[model samples]
Target: MDDQTDSPDDYHAICLGTAARARGIATRYVDGVYSRFHPFPSRWLALAAGGREYLFASGMLLLKGSDPWRGLGLHINEEATLLIRDKQRAKDFLDARGFGTPAGRVFRRGDLSAALDAFSSFAGPVCVKPNQGTKGELVFPAIADRARYESAVRRVAARHQKILVEESVSGQLIRFFFVRPRVVAVKLSRPASVVGDGSATIANLIEAKNALRDRRAVPGHSNIVVDEDLRDFLAMTGRSLDDVPAAAERVFLRGTSNGATGADSLGCRADLHPSYLDVLAAACNAVPGLNLTAVDVMIRDPAAPARHGNYWILEMNRNPGLTPYHFPWRGEAQDVSGAILDAMERGFAPVPASPPASVPASTHSMPAN
Candidate 1:
């Protein structure tokens, strides 16, 4: 056997298994890469959790839990989430069901002319990403010009056959985790940024920030990278790596608000409006059997009440991970896995109390060009 087990995927699995054990649920790490787990064998991997047998695969725990989604009749299985892996198809499905998303077009590989043409008339800032993407990989947020949009397309198209070019939605990347018809937890994610200490250059400041992040043994935290994206972002602001900003000034490093990309998260379940719950439930109902999922929403004004038609449902993540939610950077940890276990065992889990407030700033502005 190999002596090393440092893969992030394994780390995530261990975290999930640990969370399950805390809820008196046994877990076994299945060693298959496929999304579905039934065809292999019943004996290869099995667990008796909360007095129920479950099949585990690719960091997802499955069981014959009661249909917690009211009359939706969703079973706990990976098969129900396959459609969402294809982002464009998922958008089409949700759009057909009346869920509002940013309007944009999809481009195939080697179709630069068509993609640039679409970008020419694109209303405003755009977002470019792969049709089949995960963990915000190769996703360029807030693409404003044709050059950047084309560069983003090339980067994403190198790996994926098709790319999605959508209008950029402004606001906080707020996420709502639903365990079937109920919002279990809410998180506010912001792009990674560093506050200038006034003395250190941007390059040195980034180094210091990354050094601090690297010392931590957390699951989701990654060092803020110094790459072309960061360079371009800084250049747009008439700054460079060697420039030093005044103290208390904040400089954003990335456009995407994914924890894997060094973004900060705050637990904000208490601040969500009651109306947001209705919208979240509606998103779940859009896809039959999508009981347990996470809805990524872009709220223009997060401080205001989340009224219907005031937010955009970015996408519904099929198999949402619990590590980031459990070990947030600056907020009380959420027992998401525990809630799942409770829901499976008793058909319901009491919503956790709102943690201490750690709301992010009300707004984020683009770097001045």
Candidate 2:
């Protein structure tokens, strides 16, 4: 939206459309709202050939077909999306089922006093964010005092009625993009940062970094903004925009690790430890009707084998962005768009009756550490 060459939604649409066309399925944009597909019979179509509809946010819809709709990128359903969108509900569900999640509590508007009281109970730093928010908007992480805690609560409360206050877990933020039976791609993200060049001030370094991002013109990537929040974050570390950082010294510009906010995304699917696969698979399978999702996990060390109380599930994304995997700031690009289409095609195929197998309960546990 900030004069970018292309938005994440636009990039995803292009990738999906191209993949669909390659599969011999006619695809065209209808008023730039959604994709119209041919050879599918659906009442929502303007012509007889219109039977399938695909949107980046909402999943695919099949008109006059055996399956009516596939929510959240043609895999997750509406119920699951709604559940995942509400951070409190989703966290409760996962935490109850032995999935490691941050210990936190939710508060509604006008409950500021109670929220502050609960904040004091935490042993270490905490994260304050909207209960139902995305793209890391209005998320304040690593808050350690009463003053910052109160300010974060009031600020977030102004925009959202519900707020979630959770313990801040220290680890690398990794996103596991799970497509039903397997984890297709993994992304490691870091907060917006700039390395010091000795002579240039922080402000100049940020401008230079933004210029590089602009030149790269990577879809879905955003420039690091020199804003009040960034300035405040620097102030907390006793630094300012005018100060010159020593050469090779890296200064983080933000607390939230979001790609849209200039955070760096790196493809790490191949680097993920094998032990995490089981943990991620069990977590994804825990949610019924949730076939495709992006599971955000905080790990102290991803290279090491996963163990209980070593990681925490931050949240789950229903319609996870595909462009990040395809156009990361660093690392190899993954064909996530093609994988979604393949899953969609498989979903539409006739199902053969199979014996129902018992689902094993999760054995993992998260102790308060």
Candidate 3:
């Protein structure tokens, strides 16, 4: 049955409609109308019917005998890669697919000791983070001493029941946006610092930082007040409001921070570098189930991305922030919605029509020609 409904919430359906329109195909969106009809076998109810029987239909209802119910279409799907949200599983899957991903290990909470020992073989500080965390919420790194590592572990453990510890990596933080296997945009989040004049206090410096941040585009890190970590960082350095850093003195509140600081980041390196395609392809193959996942990758260097070494994939995002694709930035469309629609249409459509079986004489009288 042809269906048309007005609902902006159904992104998949909307994309299908948009794609169909772009391709010059006549299409309609049907929402909730299927429930109005009796749930009888489709073949019985879908027999070619007279126009009078469908007088109340919003659009033409294809009968089983002739139409075979193949016209149904939808916008999104449950099977898309968007459903695969786990961190370690995503990495293993990506690595198997030949994607240049980080070197690390995943273990259950009980087995963290062994995992830690295994990483000790490598020379470098290790980072500890929660398996599922928003932004850099539970991420900490560059920890060498065992006591500090234990402290960080305790703090992280208090917040989360489980955590992950891996080798510390030094590189540029880049977010590669993807829909399924396609890369749409590359955003480089550089760990940057800003200096303050001698006149402003540390508090005032932060306030000025926040004032310069662009709220409409990227939320400025400056707007985010000093957390416990920032406070501790300030205290350990023995600096207060009176001491002003050298003019344009670079001060880093976050060691691995690349996103917005106090000011909105300029589009200094907005374009995607040409070298990240191989890693992107490997990431897509790694998670076969994900429909759309943004792979958070760390490259030692972008100019020599591959030459530097394998790009470590921090994690694969399942439910990515969607606005960046079309709203403010007008990022490229992966057209994943269209792919979902195609899958839904093929999946939900009824079995194709076959030769009608010869039936016994009907009890009802047949009209004589």
Candidate 4:
């Protein structure tokens, strides 16, 4: 795993496998193959065979022994998973509960006119994305006019029946990897960018950067793509591939900060404000049976104390990719997989006669969905 030779899915599996081995739990990939297409395995399975048999798939765990295992793994039920998948519904739920989430609306493909109307009502630029999208695909951000809004909606509608139009928040994207009762890791996502040299053209800098990425072969890091989108993004800034930027100037290559789309993932757990941690814990606890999740947030400054309007909860992920935390390009790697397994093992332990007094009261309650 340290060599970073495996894909994100393989890395996650390897991390779990390694942790399981240390716990004397036997494990193996069900198909003996790793999926290159998904952050998690589509078919990979981990089986712990000893006095008890445990099966793990895409963060779900099944225990088999004298007692039958419940369908939920890490206390994450199907209902909660489905709720989080529906971006609009999840945001509505959080908003109604006084959680800090962006105001947004959803429209079906046939309701393009309604979406446009809603976009106009927004005071600032809005983002158009699929209601059930992931990995930032089909997500168009920072649209300030009707033309871009309509085009973005139509483009998203081509792939999804429903689109989510929300006011775009200006900030850095941060991911908080939460396992019951705590955030195990935090990552800052930055779009693919290059610091300019005194004389090199933007095109040459991009080429060199891609070459470096190839040489380093950092798992889950994608090569900066040179495409129409990149060209358009540069054009918006009155520059082109041929332009030479002054030395030390950094030029971003993409607007979407997604790992699959050439974003740089940096582990920043140590730099996260304690207030944000409190907010994250409270947010995760608000959703019933949401034991393991990745909460994406937009914050102007992570070091600043979290306030009502300073940060917005983007969405929660049921199965977040662990590769970013394990192999961040700029900071210390975190053991998110290990924390997940720790939670699983804790689930199997016998309940104590009395709950620990030091444990916070919030941790004991699960809000009804």
Q: Can you write out model 1's per-residue Cα lDDT over 1-369, one digit (the tens) per residue?
A: 222222345444555557666766655533432224333312212346546665443335455343453221223634446666677777776565555567768889889678767887777888999887878889887878788888888888889888899888887788888886577788988787888988999889888888887777666777788888778877755788998889999888787888777788778767766666766666664455565777788887766665434577777786676767887877888877666766666643322233224312211121011
TM-score of 2: 0.83
Instruction: Order the numbered candidates by lDDT, best leading.
Output: 4, 2, 1, 3
lDDT of 1: 0.67
Error of 4 at 367 (Å): 14
Scored by lDDT, model 2 comes in at 0.73
RMSD of every prediction: 9.0, 6.3, 15.3, 6.1
**Scored by CA lDDT, what does every candidate get?**
0.67, 0.73, 0.48, 0.73
> Which residues of candidate 4, in runs, are more than 4 Å off?
1-9, 31-42, 49-77, 348-369
Model 3 TM-score is 0.59
The alpha-carbon deviation from the true structure for residue 153 of candidate 4, after best TM-score superposition, in angstroms, is 0.7
Tens-digit per-residue lDDT, 221-299, candidate 2: 8999888989888886789999999999999999888877899988776666777777887777666666677889998
Residue by residue across 1-369, what tens digits does model 3's lDDT show?
434442344332344455545655455533223222333112111111222111111112222222233332211112332324456555565554445555555445665566445445557887877765655676776677666666666666667656767777777666665644456555555543447675666666776666555344332233636666665445544665456777666565555553423322223234445557655644453343444456677777666544325457777664443322222122334444344334333433233133124212212211111
